[model samples]
Each structure stands twice: as structure tokens, then as C-alpha cells.
Target: MKKITQELIDRFYDLLSPCRLCPRNCGVDRINGELGNCGAGLEVKVASYHQHFGEEPPLVGRSGSGTIFFSHCNLHCVFCQNYEISQLGQGQRVSLEELAQYMLDLQNSGCHNINLVTPTPWVPQIVSGLKIAQERGLHIPVVYNCGGYEAVSTLKLLDGIIDIYMPDIKYSDDQCAEKYSKVKNYWSVVRSALKEMYYQVGNLKLSRGIAASGLLIRHLVLPNQLAGTKECFKFIAENLSIKIVVNVMAQYYPTFNAHKYPEINRRITLSEYRAAIDILKSYGLDAGFQQTIDTLYRKAIPEWGEWS
Candidate 1:
């Protein structure tokens, strides 16, 4: 029912030949088992799928958001909470038709949207499967939940397809991103990606307490200002819009290989969270959700599983 043409699907699948999907631009032939930075093969591997209520309120609503956690990730962050799935192999391979069925199943369960998590690696397969799902009467908003290290060219292919762009503005500095997330030129790439996403869909628009379509950014406040909340907020306010929905996350903890980096191997201090809030307020980017400082103290350990 949507404008998911065969031509659009072909364009995305062609990227897998040399695999120019993400900014990594590894150019590896993923179809032939050649591994790229994300290490995803041709098939659509899925870690999990369910109605997730832990997401932002608008996405969750009353029925809960449909979450399909994809296998592997382009940005292998040292502090990734979902390291088992994103870094190590923890997903089961599924056919394109099966992938489409997952989407339909979620919709049948009364989900508000299809939240595709860490889906940058398998964009080609996702597009093809989404076409099948769209043709089979799937009519929910498709949420592109990803780390902000996206390629504008690749995202262009998803222009008319994706309804909501919920990406994390992970870092405002390339050095920090490279050191922790193993990404190059992250600062520059994320900015361009964010602009393109905003161009496709404007600020987040809610319909009866549910997100209909738009860009909702998430910025996790890392310990000791590692996330550079000030610069990220400033860029969003000045470039994107002050009306943008930015979920300033406080769910950072030492996990996966995060202990290797002593600077970021600890939970963010209360003062640090407050400082990040101050920066968000200074830019008047207050249209989104903000977690209370005490929320961090409740999580003694990193018990929460976060995709971003």
C-alpha cells in the first residue's frame, strides 16, 4: 500500500554488492560472505522481536512499540549495553519472508509502530522484506531506530519509506566516538545524517499521545561529559530546531568492553546528569523527554538492555 516499489528495493539491494550501505563504506561483497565492518551476511538476522514498553512514551503508547532487534551493528561501541547481540553473535538468521512476517505479527498484536533497532547493517534486506510486509497489509509507522553514524546516500534510499527517524546523536566529537565506538568522522557524518532525516520528516508530531511521524533524537549522557551534551544540543537547536524531541538518556554504565576505557567505565555522576540537563535547557531544546537525575541511582547495575 505504501510506495515501496521494486525499483526502490533493487536500489538498496545493489548496495550489498560492494556494501556501501553505511558510512563505513567497506565496499565488501556481503553477498559472497565477505565481512564488512558490521560483519552482517546477506540474510536478515534477528536477535529478538516484541512489543517493547521501555521506549519513549510516544512510541510505546498503550499497546507498546513493536521492536525488532537486528543482528550486528555498524558502530561497535565499547559501552554498548546490547553487546551480546551487537558485538558478539546472538541472533538467528531469518528469511526475507520471515522478516516480513515478524512485522505483520507485531502489527497484529496492536503495536503502535515497527521499531527496527540497529538496522544499519541489513538495510537492503530490510527494504525488501518491508516491501513484502507493506504489500501484506502492514499499516503501522516504521521507526528507524539506529545509532547516528549513518550515511546520507544510504538514508536517501529510505526517504519515502521510513516514517519515523529515532536515532541517537551519540557524540559531538569524532575522537571520542572513534575511541569508544570505533567510528571515523562520526561528528561530521551524524550531523549530515540528522539534517537529512529532518528533511524527510520534520520535528516529532504526536497524535492522541502517540508518535505519528518525525525525528526523535536520543543523547545518552556519558560520564564526565564524554557524550558532549552541550555541543550536541547546540547543534540540534541551531541547525535542526529547538522544537525537536531529544531524549537525553541517563542510562550509561560500564558494560561490555567499557571497562577497558577507565574514563567511561563508570556511571555518570548526578552532577554530570544535571550539567547535561543545563546544556539542553540553555539551547531551549525542551520539547522532548528528560529523565530525572534520581532515575540513574535506581539502577545500581546496568540491568537495562539498551540498543543505543
Candidate 2:
């Protein structure tokens, strides 16, 4: 593994001037306080940091996944359950040192890994913080939990740094992506992003029944076939390794601005979720962790930031 050097940190921070950290390529100078489409600055802002057991069983043993919810998102999804944190940007800015301390603190709490949620816009600063965190004995695997929309160039910068590349494979159809998430060419971008991530770290590796490294994809089952599981699973099975674990998430509940779009205004039915899972299984993709339909009904819909 490559050590997080000051030179490497500088290399990432320099990208802030042009700010092509995400797929948006907004070209805004984030260093000079110019907000890009992602609405993040040079500093890293975190909404919350805690040991969350709500994650997958492998990620959450007896302890929990050390989850850090970052504010703002690259994709403006109409049904974002965590709109307050992702779209509204409800979080506090923390210095690089402070971010490093959070890593150590989470490690001290006996959590498995540092799970960074919606960390797309803050990659540069996150790397800077990791430099400090690693030097201070932060030895646990770092999970890059992000939305599927990612820049391959930006992801390359984190090739060796990010241990577990856990990302959401939102949609296989670009039209659905643009309509729901308001992102252009999302399917094209995500396909490349997943390839790069899998290239960096292949399939999920477990130690003592806990995830230590590699890729775990999430595909949220949307109401009405908006998620397009067949094509998404086909791509993963044919392009990436079928051994790669995929979490077929059925927790989509209408929130935020979802009511504006009638197609996705209601929660997904059990049959809809099951069909998506069938698609996943047909592709020979490992259904990593699953929630029973009864369990889904019994539990409250967790905010995306909190859902892991």
C-alpha cells in the first residue's frame, strides 16, 4: 500500500483550483470559496460521526462501522432521504487535524473501519486528514462509501488509500439517472467508476467475518423499475467479477422532493424489491446483506446518511 505522503496530499489539494474532484467537472475554484455543483469548499465538513451498526453484517460485527456522514452530495436526487445533510448541507466544517482525530477517535471506539459517506466533494481534504490519521496509528481499513457517480480520475488518486470501495450503483439507465438524480450520463460515468474501483480493490475480503478491504456495491430498489436492476447487474456480472458482493437495498421511501415526481412518490412494494433481487441473483452476484420484507416494514426508514 502506498503511504499517504505530503506530496500526494498536495497533488489532490491542487485539483481544487480547477475542481474536477467529482464527475460534474464544474471547473469552479473551490480553494477560492467558489462552490461547485457539489456545494463544498476546501475544508471537510461532517454532519455526524458515530459507530453505526446499521451497516451490513460484515461491516458491523459486535462493534460497528465507524461511519462519518459528510455534508452535501454530487447528485441532487429528488428522493434523498437525507436531504437535510446531503442537499441542505447541515454539517460543521472540521480542520484536517480534526478530521484525523475523528479517525483515531472512531478507531479507539473499537469500530471496524472508517466509513466515509457522501465523501465525493471532499476527497482532497479527506486525503490530507488520512495522512495525519495514518501517522497517528489509524490502522483500520478505510471504506470509501460513496454514491456511484464518481470521476475515474479522482478515484485513481485514491487507488491505494481507500481500502474498501463501497459505492452505490444507482441506475443503469442514464435517463432514469438524469430524471431522478439530475445527473447527466450517470450510467456511462458509473460504469467506468465501478470498473476503476474494482480494478483498485477487487471483491470484498473478510477477516473474522468483518470486511477488511475491497468493493461492495449497493443498488437501491426504487419504485416502478426506476433503478433498472437487470442492466446494472448484467454490467457487473459481465464486466466486473461476479464474486463482488452487491447489497440490493429495498429501503427506498419517498421523502425530500419525491412527491413532485409521482412515479417515485410511494415506497417500493415487496414484490418490486424481490424482483430486483432476482435480477441480482440471475447475474450470479452475491447478495451480501439483505433485509426481510417484514423487517423493512417493522423498522423506520433510516436517513441515507444514517443507513450506511
Candidate 3:
């Protein structure tokens, strides 16, 4: 693995000036106190941070993945489960130095890895913090948990900085993406982003049942086939690799503003979830995890942050 040098950190911080950190490419000078489309400024805003066991098995093995949830996502998903943080911008802004301490603190708490949730817009600050943390002997794997609407150029900057790439393959259809997430060309953008992510980290690699590095694709089974599960699986099996770890998430409940769309105004039925599993198996992409329908229902159905 290439070392994350001070020069690399400087280059990443430069991106914040023009703010091409994510796919949105708002081009606003964030260094001068301008907010981008993602609603982030020079300071990093965090909703919460905690040791979370609700993540994938590999990520949550033994202890837990130290998750830092960022505020205000780039994609405005109408049915977002965590709308309070992602849409409403509910988080406290902290300096980059303080953010570095959070990473070290998670490591001190015996977290297996530093999992960054919704971290795309704040990549510059993240990289800066990682550099500081590295100097302080922070050596756990860094997980880039994002919504998959990433820019290849931006991801290239994180080639060695990020280890585990846990990204959502949200939609295979641009129409559905635009209608639901208010993002343009979501299919193409995510497709290219996934390819770049795979190229950077390859297939998911585990060490002692815990994720050490590599790519893990997350495909949430949206109701009424809006997420295009079959298409996403086909693309992964053919274009990427069957060896890639894929989490066919079945916890699609109508939360936030999902009632506005009748098609996705309910939880995914058992048959729907079963069909998605069948499709996943048919593609021969079998190295990942799945949530049982019973497990989803047993959990409290609330539109809240995972940190709380």
C-alpha cells in the first residue's frame, strides 16, 4: 500500500478550495467559508460517533466498527431513513484537529476500524485528520462508507488513505435515481465510481473475521424494484467481480417522505426480499451478508441516527 504523505494531504486539502470533493462539483471555495451543495463548510460537521454493532458482520465482529456519522449528504433521498442528519443537517461542526482526536479516540476505545459514514463531502478534512492521527500511531483500517455517488477523481486522492470501501449501489436506473434522490445520471456516476473503488481496493479482504481492507458493495432492496437489484447484481458479476462482497440489504421501510411516493410507501414484503436473494444467488455473487425479514421487524422502526 502507498503511504499517505504530507504532500498527498496538501493536494486533497486543495480540493476543498474549489470543492470538487464529491460528484456534485459545486466548485464553491469552501476554504473561504462558502458552503457547497452538500451543506458543509471548512469545518467538519459530525452528527455523532460511537462503536456500532449494527453494521455488517465483518465490520462489527467482536467489538464494533467505530462509526462517525457526518451531517448533510450529497444525495437528497426522499425516503432516507436518517433524514434528520442527512437532510435536515443536524450535527455539530468541529475543527479538523478535533476530528483527528475522534479517530484516535475510537482506536483507543478498541474499535477494529474507523468507519466514516456519509464522508464524501468532507474528504479533505478527513484526509487532513488521518494525517494527524497517523502521526499519533493510529493504524486501524479506514472505512469509507458512502452513498456511491462519488467522483473517480476524488476517490483517486484516497487511494491509500481509505482501506475498506463500503459504498451503496443505490440505483441502476437514472430515472429512479432522479425521481427518488434528486440526482442526475446516478447510474453512470455510481457505475464509474464503483469501478474506481474496486480498482483501488479490489475484492473484500478479511482478517480474523474482521474487514481489514477492500471493497464491499451495499445494495438496499428498494420496494417495487426501484433500486434495480437484478441489474446491479448483473453489473457487479460481469463488470466488477463475482468475488466482490455484496450486502443485499432487505431493510427498506417507508420512512421520512416515502409516503409521498405510493410505490415505496411500505416495507419490503417477504416475497420481495426472497426474490432479491434468489436473484443475488443466480448471479453467483455469494460472498456477503443479508438481513432477515424477522430481524428487520424486531428492531424498532424509527427515523433516527444510528449513533443515538
Candidate topping lDDT: 1
lDDT of 1 by residue, 17-122 (tens): 8988998899999888888888798888999999998888889989999999998999989999999999995999999999999999999999999999999998
Task: Give TM per candidate.
Answer: 0.96, 0.95, 0.94
Give the alpha carbon lDDT tens digit for every residue of 1-308 in model 2: 35899888888988889888888989999999899888898778999999998887778888899999999999999999889999999999999899999989999999999999998999998888888998889999999998889999989999999999999999988899999899989999999999999999988888987888889998898999989889989999999988878877777889999999999999899899788867877877753555666644667332221112
lDDT of 2 at 204: 85
lDDT measured at residue 306 in model 3 versus the true structure, 0 to 100: 16
Model 1 clash pairs?
none
| Residue-wise C-alpha lDDT for candidate 3, range 1-308, written one tens digit per residue | 25668888788888888988888889999999999888888888999999988888788888899999999899999999889999999999988788889999999999999999999888888888888888888899999999999989989888877899999999999999999999998999999999999998998887987888999998898888889999999999999998887887877789999999999999888888788889988998876656665645676222211110
State each model's CA lDDT, in order.
Answer: 0.89, 0.87, 0.87
lDDT of 2: 0.87
Cα lDDT for residue 220, model 1?
Answer: 93
